[model samples]
Target: MPVIDQLRDSLGWDVVLTDDADRDARSHDTWPVATVWAKLGRHPHRPDAVVRASSVEDVVTTLRIAAQTGTPVTAWGLGSSVTGQPLPVAGGIVLDLAGLVSEPVLDEIDRTVTVAAGVRGSDLESWLGERGLTLNHSPQSLGRSTVGGWIATRATGQFSSRYGGIEDLVVGYQVVLADGTVADLGQRPRAAMGPDLKQLFLGSEGTLGVVTRVTCKVFAHPEHRVVEAFTLPDVEAGLTAMRQISQCGLRPFLVRFYDRDEAAHAVPHEEISAPVLFLGHEGLTSVATAEHAAATAIVASLGGTSMGAAPVDAWLSRRYDFSTVENLLAEPGGYAETVEVANVWSRLAPMYAELKQTLAPLATEVLGHFSHVYDQGSSLYMILLGRADDDETALARLEEIWARAMKVVVAHDGEISHHHGGGLARQPWVRESLGTGYPVLQKLKDGLDPAGLLNPGKLGFGRR
Candidate 1:
């Protein structure tokens, strides 16, 4: 109470939100499991106060005050964390960074955009589009997520194959630590630096520090764009096609192989009777031509039937629509979620089968799609759907699905999560995912946040 009064008096009374309505609104993310907890009035992790930070100075001051008082601070963006990363489970300060955006500075010569962290993805994209430039970072949550949240979560975009993920796009960032110290990390295109310190905070899910500004690589709008679609017999066959394409050194701007259940939602046509593949290319005309041709040849050799461009075009048009999850969440007995994991090609097929088989009994619809491919491996994004007669049963089903999927991910040598980041939902598995390296994270927590005050319970770092 004293800290709240102090913060209100010191940081401006308007910035501190102690009203019940305000705290209740900032309490959760897109996580349905957490939503269920809220519905049951089990908000044990709700924040004591929600602070609307107006600038980097505001962020620094709040962290200092919270640190001085031994309180946990969770950085909040658009609150779109599907993994519950933004939830202030330890009940301290939820630093809402949604209002801290500043004017974006674009460098035509360097092809980079320097902006504050509060800029939402859509706003950035629109600004770039006006200048015939693009960041090519289009995640499903683009419309709601802030640039800082993407860096914090280590998220992947749909066009990652050509443009790379957020980690690859970010040249540098400014992070405010637990003690109110600001560090500017990575300034050049490439550096001979020993270790990129910015990476320590990326995907740290607010456990390390609060990111405030970033400089990222951007691109001129693509001159050529190509789209292609195919129907594969099964997920294994689809994975094979994708793996071959990636291994052959062809980088398509978009590559998605969806299982039947998932395919139906994308195309929803009777002709698409099996698993489907959506492929595309965008960049120099020659590069697009070469990559698209090579990918088509690889998939055709694997017995994939060409399905024309209608389905792929359809997917592109509505890729960011999250209506399914939203609609389900609105229902009394419906639940759905997308969980993703990564593994090498050697274990890719088996891991996919194991995860689906384990989740099959608990779900009404289990769909799988592979994206964000690498030379050695790819990430699998699985959509799980289920229903019950009531909220209690639906919540139990949702929790069970996440629990089972996590076990399969660990048992099969897959990372607990590929792009979702380790939030409250994945906190317990973070240690196992890190193994011998887990202690390193703990040490980082101890050294950087000695008071255990920054996003205290995430990534299995710091005590709750």
Candidate 2:
């Protein structure tokens, strides 16, 4: 019998899907390339079968069968990855983990919540809110992305400056390795017991194993929040202020710096003639107030003009809205993609300029911004908007844009991706980006997934 039939026989028809529509739906993610493919009425390597796994036992059985048959398996959540991380590139079993859920268990005393991987981020936050607690993770896809997807992609949120990224938030995980071996890693708040095993799956993109459940740190909902906006003289001034604020140990929950072009769009007021900066602090009322005031002084010292709370408030109201890109991509010949890269403080500005200059010809508009910051550096988010005569041409332009952007980023010694995992989009440059680390990744993959069946063709593994 075929692999699909075997899956159906073992897991039942309800759990194993083989129809065209089911396979196609499980095939691609929200990758811009996939979006273009959708616009052109094409599928990017549909899976042979989609297993709607409802329990850990179901996952174990599917993986065991896959291992026995030497079939590939790609784990999927809500299909929200923009880098094609969930795409079933090698057509075997697409394990739909969204159906595999357990009620969230909150330990208020420990300030931790253990949730099934399929839990949507927004839903998780809402649950926490009702109890006067919060995960404080606010990704653009919060409404759609799941906990599994966040861990798989090493996701970060807008409030990452203060709360840290998924890597920092994750306390422990339940993972199912390739050969049906189940591992429950990370039991402590901190440990020196050899290397941290959970880190292996944080950004593995389902290549190493499947992340089924996660326990993350949570905090009491902020008692107060302070928002302040500034207009910097230029990118240099804005970055300098950001670096100082970060290095001085000020933990603002939010920081957004937009380049002139992006600022024009973000602020959209005639008085705004320079780069824009927005800072937000949240926590205990007194602490939030102090941080906000300190950050304000730094901005003022850097010649930043006060823009009050109006702009920041406006942004907070619609921070999660992604319809702009959605509507653009929905057009017949439209192309929009975001390339996010990061580097140390010294190299950030130059790399940002180089990327903008290099990618200028590839797209109609290249809007840049810095949202997530650390003491050492910050993530640069570049939004490319373009149009072509037809969908085919638009797809070609999208590919070209990514190619050029990656080349520029690598040349500058910057991370090819800050939060987005190495999906099909960044697969080609993974070797160069990881340098000596790439081989180590291969070794890990070999040891954990000798058959190379888990999420093949991603993170630079099992490439033909």
Tens-digit lDDT string for candidate 1 (1-464)? 88898799889989999887778767878888877766666665688998999899999999999888888899999989898999887888999999889889988898899889999999999999999988889999999999999999998899997789999999899999999999999847667668878678889888889999989988888899989888888878888998889888888888888888788877886556689898998889998898888889989988898878887888888889998888887788788888889999999889988988899998789988888889889999888887788888988998888889889999987988989988878877888888999888788889998888888778887553
Off by over 4 Å in 2: 269-271
Q: What is the lDDT of residue 57 in candidate 2?
A: 90
List model 2 lDDT by residue over 317-380, tens digit each: 8888888888889999998999888999999999999998999998888999997999999999
* Weakest ten-residue segment in model 1 by summed lDDT: 36-45
lDDT of each: 0.87, 0.90
Candidate 1 similarity to native, TM-score: 0.98
* lDDT score for candidate 2 against the true structure: 0.90
TM-score of each: 0.98, 0.98
